[model samples]
Target: MIPSDDRQPPQKGLFELYLEDMINLRHPLVRMAERIDWPQCEQQFGPYWCPDNGRPGHPIRLHVGLQMFKHMQGLSDRELLDQWVENPYWQYFCGESTFQHEPPMDESTMGRFRRRIGEEGARALLRMTVELGEGTGTVAPGSFRVAVADTTVMHKAIAHPSEARLMARAHRRLVARAKAEGVTFRQTYERSLDGLLMRIGRYAHARQFRRMHKRLRKLHGYLGRVCGDVIRQKPYGQRSQALDDSLYQALYLLRQYADPKHRPKLYSLHEPEVACIAKGKARTPYEFGSKVSVITTAKEGFVLDCQALRGNPYDGHTLHEGLMRVHRHCGHLPVHTLVDRGYRGSEITPLSNVRITGKQKGKGTAHPEHQHRRNSVEPIIGHLKHEGLLDRCHLRGHDGDRIHAVLCAVGFNLRKILRRLARLFGLRFIQELLGLLRESGTQTGQSMNQVVSIPV
Candidate 1:
């Protein structure tokens, strides 16, 4: 059974102090927690859980609160949990009634929670952030009428894809698996493989192509011998799932390098969904990651959606689908969609007025004065990378990419909401201070120049 978040508060003991009394309730995080509908959040995640004989799971708010904190603070799973223990404001945001000494959940439980939510539930989380923005007037519904969209590369957490690195990685993996599966190869190449791989790297760096090629051939021969030994044992049908998948990658890498004429050399053995995206920059010619389409309102810059495009589809081909994602996530679509020159020939669209910002210059689009508004999304994307976790994805496969993109959006909107609340709180505080000062001087019958201290 899912843990009910709407339970009654515990009765305060004679000597116990409440967390609400200890902390400043005017804090933005405290106000944010109060405004969030916890029951609705529990309902969104209730279907994903099953009513078992096991004890009730942790409250959905706790897990989701940690998730938002993870991205908002740019902390890893372990880092977030460690800090969660020290921060009482964070505890209050997660629905804690009293200050806790230990973390509510572990790092592994957080990972399991993400898996349970999946991509659809991740989108639901994004929708909830959007709804939070709307309810607080942080994002206006009318602003969603005109939106800007752009694509960016969200890099994967992998080393540079080089032949030497891949070959060494494969050889080590094969040797480890062979040892684990009780199938030993003839020569494990443990004696001199390190020197050879090192020499190969130095040769390439020193502009010694001939030496690099010679050392690479030895590495290739060593890999081939080990691969042949493992394949002969026929571990495919009987080995563990991980080993089987590693063997497939080894085979793919072997075939990929057997010929020197392979064009697309940028490939990751571990992450199959990663693609090379070329944005035509002189400093960095190609980026190895996934292409993500970002949609935000032209006026408010509130992100409507962030769609991770697989297979590195062309920008023009992704417009219609991006709009659909915006509609699905935000419960509405833009009457006017603005895009850049990359989507020039994108004629087929769900919206009747798909405005190419460059082509429209001042032509037949629905919103002409908002031509410069398309550039608003660029800063938002930049913020997502810098302030949020969209810079480099640390999660695993295709599903990880989708979930991470949506969470980054959630973090972005969360910050905006918090900032708005903080500003409004600041103004209210100043107004109250002025009122107190005026009342103090009037009651004391003193001149306005004389000062009076107000007890805060």
Candidate 2:
């Protein structure tokens, strides 16, 4: 039966669907949507699907575009759809007419679309955004004279796993779901779960050292057996591919399990190859996201290059790649590039035209301003984390993580454009005022010089 919330009138107009009374010009996300080339974005992201043969009316392109805008503004899908229904301006931006009516698009459809398009499509969207910025002169050309770079970790969305707990959970959940769906399982999962959970709880909470060790050993043994059964059956493939990936990763982690004192390698059931990255900060000592490197134009603060670094590589090692990306994006190499102390090294010191701080790579003296300039990227990273939604990611795997990071960067650039446009009038006013002050000062100085000459 449909819930009370599901009941709605059949004869509602498109405008009647939305709750928002109006779309304000001052809304940053709305303004950003205007600057985008909708035609180009559509052409780039438009997938193959016929109108009748497709899911229904309201093309997938329109749905995807609306969803992207919503995410860029950090709105939920339901909220976005509601806003579209009520506000006419939002309807116009989303490619809807005044009288159209059909709930914007199902939330599940958006997820399926993201999965269908994969990370590559998302990256293309980000690239298009960057290209648009370049076309608009928002991204200044060759301004890498002093580029700032930093790294942060975005933690995965899962609890810390244990050898016993992982195996038990996977086994129980898989068996239960399969049984409910009327599938057969060779092993008894309930017994395994109870035994494993009891032992693990002991290991986790036991105060006595001897009891803890015994409980942990038993837990390991039980979980090891469960892992063998699951691997043998390969239940992951039968259920969901995403779940399959997660189970495979959990199995790998179980195999690598050791003392709690040992550091856990970056392992997510969803994205096994995710790297373990560490950026030395007082507040956040460790981060789980890929080592993403971004270089921006010093003058305009436009992103020149953004790439998800493979492995937790050294800061200096990424300089060449970062520069290459910048060159590719801007179509020219920067005359001068500035980096932080972490990038300083003997190998890089002798490089001509590149300005890096800290101990010169080969013993040449470091630049005094390098540290201060390197500090500039700190705020950019903070902005991406807090405002651009890079702080946490909901997608699975490295590719998903990479695409998410790039999108956040795109959002950041769009926001920068919005603020720049807003401040342009104020900045022009300040410039004019400064010019008048300078002219008046010059006239007064000339009068003083003439009076001195007459006295002489």
Candidate 3:
């Protein structure tokens, strides 16, 4: 018979054995995570209880949440779930006892969980990251310094909508969804949008076009009656009220623009505030969402604040909120914040703390270092759009846009943390292993008896 040891499967790898062990001893983020009151931070999410006498799922929630947060930054839920099955590191992070066949929650469940957390929860997550950074001894408390500011457009996830098309689509979608959800109505239009689309798409003959427009007008009027009936009939309950509020808002905008007024109101049920913002870049002539300003530290490039401003306000106007977020994140106001020419204005110049870079009125000594540092944030904006998840907004409403931006910032910080952890781990591993090698006479030429200590 084979011995027990001989019969056993191969020993689990050091990597598979423990994730904490894989983490570098001196990695700042790791050290910071350990020091923070994660229990307190995690309390914001859960006190999940079991059904029978209800055992708490707090540990599971926290672990799973942190894993989700990582995934929200680095990968999709489907991709993360796949990794959890195969990668020990990911499984360990997610608190899996065994390689699970299914994810702890489905993708839709993940979305609901995010909604439950809402914008406030996302902000809390950001605060936790900032706090962790501060506790790490890497960033000094008061010295969380200059945050460079810039804006990028996050596109809404709907087809580019024209005024007429948007109104028609918005009206149809609201009615369809409302009806499907069992909301009562006196009348609902059975007409398809094909005719409306055709009429709008073809504009050759004035006489025929007016005939088509009259038909479209009748359809719009019919939709309005259906919406009004639904509004009157539906009970004033939580869910229905919320739906009604949104539907009515869309309907209001559509009707406001149906007949040409001084200004045509833009409306899209899918993404109501999807604006046509032009930033004047040669590559991207126009972007289809609100302009969001992101501010980050110059020292380590950690994002301090992000805001989704509607109507693409001038950069100078958003300064107060940006600076306020920096203060909130760092627990101290930033000194000598840097910005480009767009942010230069009398309103901004009054704040002695903010240092604006642009063409000087007269030739004077230029601080090349400040100008260089001012431009540093531009790459950060690109990274957020290209690599991080801020290129497009998957959610709807202004709140959704804000959440997307915050999640991107959080994702970026996590990536930063992972890179720092990997680098530190590698350096320490090489040093300690090299010393061990010297001691073991692994290096044949080295004196075996000599004591070997790794240099810091």
Q: lDDT: which candidate is best?
A: 1
What is the TM-score of each predicted model, taking all chains together?
Answer: 0.91, 0.69, 0.73
* Rank list by lDDT: 1, 3, 2
Q: 1-456, model 3: which lDDT tens digit per residue?
A: 110112113455543445555444465444434555645654655533223454333343334344435434566667765665665444444443334455555666566556666777777777776876665433455445566788778887777666556656666667777776777765555565666667766752445667666756666776677677666666456346556766776567646656566343464565666677888989979777888999887777778887788776888888887777766666677766777778766234443266667656433443334445877788778778777778877776888788778878877766666666567666788999989987777655454334354344
Give one digit per residue, the lDDT tens place, for model 2 in 309-426.
Answer: 6678887787777676655555566655666657655135332245555445544444533434655676777777787667777767766676676767766776676676557645
Number of the top candidate by TM-score?
1
Candidate 1 TM-score over all chains jointly: 0.91
- Clash counts for the predictions, in order: 0, 7, 0
Using lDDT as the yardstick, the better of models 1 and 3 is 1
Quality of model 2 by C-alpha lDDT: 0.60
Q: Model 1, range 1-456, lDDT digits (tens) per residue?
A: 677675336676676556787899899999889888878888889888876756788888998899999988878899999999898899889988778888888899999999899888888888888889998889887888888889999999988788888888888887897779888777899677789988998999899999998988888888888888888885468777877877777777777788666644537877876887888979878888888899998887888889777768889888888888888877777888888888877767756367777674445544477777878989999999999989999889988999999889888989999998899888999999999999987877764335554444
Residues forming the 10-long window of minimal summed lDDT in candidate 2: 1-10
Query: Which 10-residue window in model 1 sums to the lowest lDDT?
Result: 447-456
Which parts of model 2 have CA positions greater than 4 angstroms off?
1-34, 47-64, 86-88, 99-102, 131-139, 142-145, 173-210, 227-254, 258-266, 282-284, 344-354, 360-371, 425-456
Name the candidate, 1 or 3, with the larger TM-score value: 1
RMSD of each: 4.4, 9.7, 8.4
Error in Å for residue 89 of model 3:
0.6
Candidate 2 colliding pairs: 18-85, 18-86, 154-289, 246-269, 345-361, 346-361, 346-362
